[model samples]
Target: MLKIRIIPTILFNNFKLVKGISFDSWRTVGSIMQAVKIYNLREVDELIVMDISATNNKSKVDLDLVNEIANETFMPLTVGGGIKSIEDVSNLLEAGADKVSINTSTFNNDFFVKEASKMFGRQCIVASVDYKIIDKEIVIFSNSGKVSQKVKFIDHIKKMEALGAGEIILTSINLDGTMKGYDIETLSKASANVEIPIIASGGAGKLKDFTDAVKNTDVSALAAASIYHFTNTTPRDVKIYLNSEKIPVRIN
Candidate 1:
């Protein structure tokens, strides 16, 4: 049995850590450095730092910030946002990112996924997808959920996997930051359609949501923000609960 991982996603805007509803209404959370240190102390499975300003602002990843977070974090670090080429991916990895997640590029030039995987290996390439159901069709969103590409969800997942992506970070724009729960329906469909590990993002409000996601979907990981950022649910407590429910989990 594979243990389900609990990861904290830190959204960056203008090189600062912020939180928002459905990826909008941004509010400052804290310094990225402070948040990384806290997650390190809590022993979370992994941490993802995404620069929401990257492509939207016509810029690249802030390596200075990446270096700061990298130096402070002890777990595997996944970085994303505004990553357009292999050179950008290389730069991020050199800055100590364990994985590079690509979103906007996939909609335009998906071959970048294979190129990135070839240069960094599949395990180091994560496909971060922003999706929403529009008129009953799962449409892909880019540019921080402002742009929607009308691609069926399964089609996109298959293409990414075939292109050598190691895993999938499927986020539900509708459920993001809502704290309602994960889009289990979407997760179930995605898991059944892809063999790669699925990381469920958005709408995690409680320990039960995490448990239900791992149990109901084939998600290898659960990613959340507000629950860990504003609420009382510690990764350790969530792990303990999952363990009690007979779900395999790594206790640190």
Candidate 2:
């Protein structure tokens, strides 16, 4: 069954779980290990742990944290941060991460994606791209969306796909944290152009947002933070709502 995956995205800064806007002003939420326990009970489809400050902070992969969380959780896990080479990918996978997400490295290291795909297989290599609307068109952003690369969203997605990225996690810098809804218009553009699975990120305020993203954009999955972290919602609830809407979703 082609079910929509309800994933909880956890951001870490300075080795602490935090949440913020456009990837700044991060406020520590909890211990990464503690967050993992909560999500395990919720039975989420998958969990994404990203150390947004690692690149800027110049820290290595939190292998101890990764090992702890992986040991506790039963769902699929993806870890990203300061991943610069194949050795980093190998270390993360060996530490028990199911997948690795690459962003900033792709611009200068185009071959990293292909090399990682060859080493870990395409399914384990996720190309995560951040974008913001410029001149009414979605443009790619790097350095945590602080600078615009000015690359059209569609062009970037095509390049990542051609580079052997197994899947793409597309986030809208403009809509991120707004809770207005997803950038479905932009998401649809990527879906129409790419055959790989697209994970829609940002601007999810309620359950309806998930339904709308999948039904409207045909994105393979929907990811959100504030909606799941600060609200009373759970992945199970999102799946139940999507199922009610006649969308396939795994229920725990």
TM-score of each: 0.97, 0.96
Off by over 4 Å in 2: none
> In candidate 1, what are the lDDT values of residues 1-252, reduced to their tens digit?
577898999998886789899888889988888888998988889998899888888899889888888998889999998999889999999999999999999988858998989878999999999988778878899888989887777899999999999999999998998999998889999999999999999999988899889888888999999898899888888899999999999997
lDDT of candidate 1 at residue 12, scale 0 to 100:
83
Q: Which residues of candidate 1, in runs, are more than 4 Å off?
A: none
The count of backbone overlaps in candidate 2 is: 0
Q: Write the per-residue lDDT of candidate 2 for residues 60-103, one digit (tens) a residue.
A: 77888889889987889988988888989999999999999998
Task: Find the 10 residues in a row with the least total lDDT in model 1.
Answer: 131-140
Leading candidate by TM-score: 1
Clashing pairs in 2: none
lDDT of 1: 0.90
Candidates' C-alpha lDDT: 0.90, 0.86
